[model samples]
Target: MTADSLPPWLRQPLAELLRQRGHAWLLQGPSGLGQYELGLALAAAWLCEQPEEAKAQGACGHCPSCHAIQVRTHADLCVLMPEVAMQALGWPLDEKSQADIDDKKRKPSREIRVEAMRDAIGFAQRTSARGRGKAVLIYPAERMNNITANALLKTLEEPVGEVRFVLASEAAWQLLPTIRSRCLGFTLPWPDSGQAQDWLVGQGVPAADAPGLLRAAGGRPSDALRLASQGQSPKAWSLLPKAMSRGEVGALSEHAPAQAIGALQKLCHDLMAVDCGALPRFFEPADLPPAPPRAALARWSRSLASAAKTAEHPFNAGLMLEALVSEARTTLNSASRRP
Candidate 1:
């Protein structure tokens, strides 16, 4: 959706805050839930001298600043993303693929490195590129490691005249408490199930597949739509039931690539959400091909939690997926055996 069509709850308050003329905001939400979009819109509004409504929301879509923000080429707006030095080499990147191609063409580090944070700080401190206030959007803000966070502390503490920092993160709690407290928190709401499902169907997903996508996404429409776009192979889903039900961790490795791990995580998450009385209507049965049973659900809940814990400690992608799959299969098997 265009920035203007952003939900009223977020747009109105943000519009009011920007109108006040000197405020920085932290928008926290699930990834792909419109935090970045709001940030860019706000940046455009800040730079736009003549907004369409003649109010705080001044970045009219027709204006040059709005267009630049939409295209992510604004002169004064600095976007700090994970650096990709090796994109030139054009290595066929895949999951578990983490080797730097070469010194000159090294792929970007998985984690946001300290150097990225430093560059962002440098840009923010420089004179505004367009004589307007400098705007910074640090995506996945928690990606900044401890050293980078420390480096950022100096800038966050002081008021850089005419400069605004917008930090967007899926997991804001991972950030240092001091940094989090410094900025205004804007918690974004996920779209309703209807909106999410409609968005998915509009994107060429068959109506039958919409249910699985919706359930998998937990009513988060954008996420469901994105996963649908990737066209995850059916083998991954086919193996999922058996893995979780029988503790057959190997079942997962047979069919799933590391890329599918994230989707698997969401699937288990959906199972947990559903078991807890929250029906995530976004996932369509056809898209994800759901297999639901009470016993299976309980097993999935127990196994997925344990697997998540293990995955966090060593970051073993294979082990994690296997554990998740095994737990889910065991759960389903138990359900079938139940009298």
Candidate 2:
């Protein structure tokens, strides 16, 4: 998407980033803040064929380079992402990798593989294909394992030819210090509540649902939009805390293990917040059941944290949801039974 279509909160940062001079940049922040969008915009601007004056506004939407990126076939741009993410975002995989997965010889990887990093390094050393310099855009850069990160280190530190690099990450702390040391770092800005709600409504979220979805996302506009796109109504989210308190498995039955765990964590967080004399962040105070005892909430919080680590590969998703809801019910009921 063109920078013009980016969320209002990102426009200023996009223009600011376009004006800066850096061969390698690291766009970092928590999830749902638009690190990937900003990184892509910066890369597009660098490779755009527009006149310098026009380029200053971000990539001119009509240029061949911009078109190529829009179609995920830009010869001068190399995107380094996990195979799963690449497919999800419409980027074509190299023939060999695609063939292997299609042939059922291997599964799409969740982490950036070392082999892909080597190919990207080779791309960096090659001559620019479209006259303009080439760029390597790596999203969720923390997905690179130690070996893969090392493969990129030398190229990142001392680039070949006119190539530039942009690594976007939701968790920058997980990156190697050397990798962090080599690139200019930019933290994505958090949009104000009003801006976030407005953007959500603009993205087709019903205006009435915007505030609740925004709250559910903890004020991350992109995340709120994602929840809307997933068919999660504001009313459904508001009812979740009470549903979990009632030990209702169907409330989270459709969610993946990881998602259910995340929803539960938010509930635990809000309950703890109310217990500590603060407002709930994810749910309205009236929507939430009475605060659980601090000790019981603390135990549940730890349990959810432990569950999250294994949520991605649960042995049985059904059993996991049942257990999680059961724990939530017990913890949520503890305060009411207090003498």
Question: Model 2 TM-score?
Answer: 0.96
Q: In candidate 1, what are the lDDT values of residues 113-152, reduced to their tens digit? A: 6776777788777887677678877766887788888888
The Cα RMSD of model 2 versus the native structure comes to 1.4
Q: Which one wins on TM-score?
A: 2
TM-score of each: 0.71, 0.96
How well does candidate 1 score on lDDT at residue 329? 54
Segments of candidate 2 deviating more than 4 angstroms: 337-339
lDDT of 2 by residue, 1-339 (tens): 568978888889989888888899999998999988888988899999988877776888788999999998899999989999999889999999999999999999999999999999999999999999999999899999999999999999999999999999999999999999999999999999988888887878899999999899888888888888888778889999889888999999888999899889989999888888999988988999988778898999999999999998999999999999999999998988755
Question: What is the Cα-based TM-score of model 1?
Answer: 0.71
